[model samples]
Target: MGILANTVSFRQYQVLGDPPAGDPGEWAGPLLAKNAFVPIDSGSEEISSGWVCLDDPQNGSFAERRDFFRPPSLAFTLRRDQRRVPAALLRRHLQKAEEEFLAAHPGLHRVPKDKREELRDTVKGALLARTLPTPSFFDAVWDLERGLLTFTGTSPNIAEIFEGLFRQTFEGLRLVVLHPFARARALLPAKLQPLLEEQNRAATDAVLEQIQENTWLGADFLHWLLAHSVAGRNSFRVRRAGPALMDEAFVAFLDNRLVLAAGPQRVTVAGPQDHYSEARIALDAGKEIAEAGIFMEKGEDAWKTTLKAETFLFGSFKAPGVKPEKDGITDEKSEREAIFYERMHVLAEGLQLFDSLLLAFLEERLAADWPKRREQLQRLLGFEEQ
Candidate 1:
């Protein structure tokens, strides 16, 4: 992995134990870190993935810590979206569907009128169902920091424990809206660089040592799942093998591709579609929804798309937790998009501020190269080099 490259999910967890020691610097606990991390592509798809750290190392350790990767909860689904459609349009669609229904069942016309009326009600409901537009989402978050570990979590409790731990560990802490992998990479100066590298290495070594002593813990989890999750020629249950499945999931979480749903339902990306725009290029940028049948949709809202030249949010991964709510489109006159940019500017500013502080702590080592380094990264803080 490059300096900014990542191979694990560094999720913002509600650290359950202690609080930060001094300044209460806060930071989020990454996901898929057990801490192991996997890498992924820009579109939240799996590219190259692996274990950054395993509960049990190759050498034996906790009965193999294996996570059972299950598909999205889509099988037993109930439409929960609340957007309503115009009653008139619904009636129109229902009437057209009834005509087709009656033509298909000439014998039904001969039945009692009351019985037909009841059947019509049932048919109309199915026919009148309208599509709900996809939702628009934005990032909303806040935080404070302490010493040792950065305590950042969406919840108050997560932040509290994060603070406590840093207080105890005197490591450092961080709390903010965005994921810190890339940001954390940016924080390391020559002096403190070794600090983070040491922590990462220390964690890895401890895991390996534990495994060597407690051997059964190494692959026990994998074996248990292998004998159970895979049966009958790699059927629909699990599309990939045990190790590969876990590896991919870790990659997905790290990449923010794993979305948590409310119930047990299966979700799969609609295979593919075609599209053309102004001839600069003709291609497909679409996503599909498939249950008993398939529903095709296009546009940026479809399939979490981004134009090639767009300054894509780099918010590539889909993390599990709360799904963002969808509000109707804002009128251009409202300057909604501009307002949004302003808010994000504020957040990006706060993170950048902390970035400066993090660098200051290591100033002694980076003093020689700080000038050039700052010039290169100034764009991150809305500045340009002279």
Candidate 2:
């Protein structure tokens, strides 16, 4: 899903290096053009991946700044085209070829392994040539000001591909996933940062290590949210900087679905959780929240999303739609630009609200009396100390 969509599922990364000194366009514009997606229709290449215009995946031209640059951000789509030959079809063709080859060799009862391998490759290539390459596009928006990148997909394989392609294209910059701990660090005030660091169990800065060591951050946050949701304590104030006003009141809570896990045991409770009885049972069984659907509301606006605990990835995040008034006087391009900015504005507001909620959790979590509070939560959820 694209960022402009009413609902978008994305994972964010922090860009870890600086660009060249001067107009960013001087470097980025040319680089984007150089790494633009190339169609594989004329060739037998199995796959191709490169950047394309965000608005038009088919248009790889990056001749103007407006193509990708939207002031403080650069938006583009990563296009991957791949051709796959059906295994059955390839096997059938290879078998036919092997039989013909063996029939031509009067003494041979079976095709040689080398000859069979060669025939298979030939058949596969022929099939690929005849097949049209299926194209897939993943949108990305780079917040140049904050050095963050929002990618519109959550698959690990695709993330790896994106990181590699981004490094290959930009040369100096690298992407680091904004995992739970990293995000917490970013959200913390200077005085409380040391407290967060003390809790970091990872000996190294590796992403997997950080997540594995800091599972408590996500687990506890969800547990806290679930506890509060059931207790009707869903109100919070904005404490992070973004599109929303400072200290603005908002309501956020877990709802619709909740995924809990303990070791290999996993359970999913769905539907409007009036009592969250199933979740409480799972908690009693030593399961913690691995993911849950989150809903946030401020006045008339609302946002809904599934929050992945381990990686903090937001799935199916539905922000309030941008309904531009019909001023029939505006051109299509101008209207598109307006919609893009408005969408980005709302998206930022949604993220701010989420981060504020996390900050609220952290404030309580890192407090001196968290152990006491945690125990209270346990008692409320009917969890026996193990």
Question: Candidates' lDDT values, in order?
Answer: 0.27, 0.90
TM-score of each: 0.20, 0.97
How many residue pairs clash (N, CA or C atoms closer than 3 angstroms) in each of the candidate models, in the order given?
A: 63, 0
Residue-wise C-alpha lDDT for candidate 1, range 1-386, written one tens digit per residue: 11011111112222233333332111122222222222221222212222221111121111222211111100000011123346786567656766776788787765356755766566544433433322211111222221111211223343344334333422343333222222333456455665544323223334234223332211221121122222211111112222122112110001111111123442332222121011101101121111111111111111111101111012221111122234566554234334333332332332233233223323422346755654543333233553
Please write out the lDDT profile of model 2 over residues 1-386, one tens digit for every residue: 78899998999999998876777766678888888999999999999999999888888888778778897898899999999998898888888988899889989998888988888888899999999999988999999999989999689988999999899998988999999999998899999998898889899999999999899999999999988987788899989888889999999989789999989888889987767989998888778999999999998999999999989999999999997766999987678888899999999999999999999999889999998998887777666555
Consecutive 10-residue window with the lowest summed lDDT within model 1:
70-79
For candidate 2, give the lDDT of residue 98: 89
Error of 1 at 137 (Å): 3.5
**In model 1, what is the error at residue 62, expressed in angstroms?**
53
TM-score of decoy 1: 0.20
* Global Cα RMSD, each model: 25.8, 1.2
Best by TM-score: 2
